[model samples]
Target: MFQFHVAPSGDDSWPGSAERPFATLDRARAAAREAGGDAVVHLKGGVHTLARPLELTGADSGITFQAYGYGTPEQEEPVISGGRVITGWQERDGVWVAEVGELDSRQLYVDGRRAERAALPGLPGEVRVTATGYVTGGGEPLGWRSPADVEFVFRGVYPWTEARCGVAGVSGDGDETVITMAQPAFGWAGELYNSTWEGQSSSGPGLPTRIENDAAFLAEPGTFVLDRSRPGRHVLMYLPRPGEHPSRTRVVAPVLERLVSVAGARDVSFRGLVFAEATWLRPSAAEGFLHYHGTGYYEGGGVETAVIGEGASVTYPAASVTIPACVTFDATENVAIEGCRFTRLGASGLGVTGGAGLAVRRCAFDTLSGAGVEVSGSRATSIEDNRVHHVGLEFSGAPGISVSGTRDCVVAHNEVAHVPHCGIVVGSGQGARILRNLVADTMEVLADGGGVYLSGPQGDSPDNQALVQGNVIKDTHTPYNFGLYTDYGASWVTVEGNVVLRADNTAVLVVGPPLENVVYRGNFWDQDPLGHDNPPSGVTYGGNVTYKDERELNAATAGIQSEAGPRR
Candidate 1:
């Protein structure tokens, strides 16, 4: 194997040896390509900021990027960051203000914690949706530095959907105000909502639940506002918490949308590193964000009728899109990522799409705006022994880990907690084995989801049927959420040997579309299963146990809980 070294203090012109290391990852990558054969690049400690994403294609295969002297006390995992530090702060009129010089960002992090954007509870007055925008009844519009920079945040047709739209203009003065929303985005969102299942309950994507990014709402401590009214002189205002000094605070704002992009690269691996501080800015554009479910959102025009069953269909926008990831893997083979840390991101942590022979293990993900790990259309993928929490920070619909449209995948032994939506979701996959995972405190903000959810068909033959087994799910809050959910037209799957506790609704939910050839066996829950006493057609329930409280549940499942989280 060809070995190379890279450090933050080294020079780009070096030969990439242990004694003389390269400064940037790009430099080491170039040397590895020239060296030929399998190569390993050792990344030294300290932050490595990327101006653009590290692109790896078919030419750069059989490479592994790892921390120098991994598993040793001397090795400090390097951080690959896509953010810029903000400085030159000054206290003005009881708030701190900084000049950013034409920078645009949707997220801000101070001392490793996500800082809230300036926001108000709702619109200025009693608001009503109109053909073009909204009109308030009788309240004065506050003195906003830039009305166009303001955005309206609305909960979509479903409780899990959180959407945002821009302001075209704010018209009218005293006693009443007319707010014109950005075109196409506002109109298309309404059209998309009306065509879906959730829209049947409401007239449209109604008035804004909250308004954000206006300086007038910058009273709360640890909240910020960005004023882009003046060209080349944009200002960022912040209200610091008690005993906090502006000069001592470390503020980071995302600059790049992605940190790494791997496409058609085989046998590539990354280990013992951290990916941090990337943002997806499409939601901040004029098109805005019209979220549907999970990471899928409505965009463009027109609608596609997706038939879930013989006579049942759901309307989706012309284009259903997902948030980008900080580290992306596409159409690769034999790729492995282990012992990595992902945090303070404005998008998903990792996205593995259309790949084969993939393995992701022992990773930690938190404080993200999107999903922790999102895999789709992959084959033989294994995601195990990871810890995910506090994600879906901005897009509340995103799950902790989701695998969709894959085959022969295994997700096991992971611990997911403190999420806004579901903990783990497997959809439209064949031969999937979701085993031994510990999911807790899920559905903290959204509704209509659960701790472990499965949908669509698993496989055609009995030999390839999916299995949901040996998992422990607990503390699923919010109404309409279950501890275990077999939603949509789930078939050819066996739900066995799992434990459920403290679910707000039912212990197990089997709904949406028609159930076919599904089995619930040997599972344990705090309460009796919902509607399982009289099982539905094509569904079988037998040999399941129910306990009354936590004392009884924990005494029965001690071994499963001990082996659920990361082993390392």
Candidate 2:
């Protein structure tokens, strides 16, 4: 086995070893592949900027990229990033501006903290559509002079879509304004003229969006606006935090979409690295979720004032909407990513498809716009002991770990919290097990969510079931949220031995489909019992350890263990 050392100061021309370190991970990976036979590339502590992704193929098998002499992931360990740090800045018009190279960039980070896009919620008042495609609304018109440059991005009548239309101009009387949307709706969420949901109607719809690249929203420190919307001027305007000068504060914009693309690579492990600020592709479909009725997202005779509609029959962010992954794997096996920090990513952290014996464990994912990990069509894959929180920040319907079309997979010992939608969603396939993960504080944004959700979208298909057991699901306070939810068509699921501590609506929620498909046993719930929305067969609930009071329940389930036995 060969050992390669990579540092920021070393050169690719030199032999990659401890004494002569390589300058970049690309150089080290190339050396390791040539060396072959379980070569190790030890990365020294520093930030490595990646203008492009590090693509690893089958030839790079058995190569391990680990930190130099580090037991656990240190704060200052090797960070492989997809952002370009820009330093030269000159303040102009109360907004610090810096000329940038990348024009289509959307995500920006200042001193390792994400910058906020300038966005205003809700129009000042209800809008009126005129003969010309102009929308006149009586609300706070976003103050903008450059009509050709500043666009009106928004969540239209269908709250499940995030789109923008170029502004013809901003015209109105004071706060009340007539904002003209571009003909086809150009930016992120764009659809047909007057397009509504599947079963909803709308007249004058659309809320003001958090418009990036606008200088109006730069209010305080740690907030930045990348102004690429203007012609010939790709400027990044930022408000630095207190005591953080522009020269000192690192301002970065995500340039690369993927950090590592491990396709057809086997027996390779990426450990103890920080992957941050990776970009995601703009949506091709509708992606946004908002229930106009209330924050609870319940629709009990709730009128549809959001879009020009009577009532809403379809949910926003339909299951078909999907974003790209940051670290993608396909047709590869025996790969692992351990002790990594996946934070401030613009998209999903990791995705594995068509592989086996792959593992993503002991990783921390935070401030992600999409899901923590997306696993599909893989068997014997393990996702364990990871901490995923503050995910699904921008995306509407992303779960913590989305497992679909995979069998004999294990998702255990992870902590998923503060998510927008479900915690762990097992969409299809059998022999899949979701166990021992502590899922809490989920559904903070959208509605009708669950900690552990199971469903098979293919109707009347084979009995698709997953072993749901030993998880402690708690604090799902969103509307229609539950500890465990088996949606319609999610059949043959065997739920067992889970401890659910809920004070909201129900502990176990079942919705739709073949009633005889779900089985529950030996579960513990101190909260209310099952909440079945509409089941033709009803749930089969038995052998459950239930408690009335919180104190008694806590005492009874104190020493309870997962099906895998006590956590080591």
Best by lDDT: 1
Per-residue CA lDDT of candidate 1, range 213-320, in tens?
988889899999988889999998888988778778888888898999999999999999999988888887888988888988888767765654444445567778
**Candidate 1, position 560, lDDT:** 71
Segments in model 1 whose C-alpha atoms lie over 4 Å from true places: 138-142, 195-201, 304-315, 507-510
Per-candidate TM-score against the hidden true structure: 0.95, 0.84
Position 239, candidate 2: lDDT: 74
- Candidate 1 global CA lDDT score: 0.86
lDDT of 2 by residue, 1-568 (tens): 8999998888889998778889988888888877874798898888887768999998899999887876743434888888877867888766677887555565777777777665544344566555333455554444653444454445424432333344555676655577665443332222222444566554433455444435665666677665555566677777766787766667778878789898888899888888887876443112222222111121122232223234433333221334668888898889888888888888888888888999887889888877889987887898888898888766656678888888778888888888877888877676777888888888676666588877763223234356788888878865666778776566667788888877355455444444455677788887656543332464667788778786887677665534332133
Q: Model 1 compared with the native: what TM-score?
A: 0.95
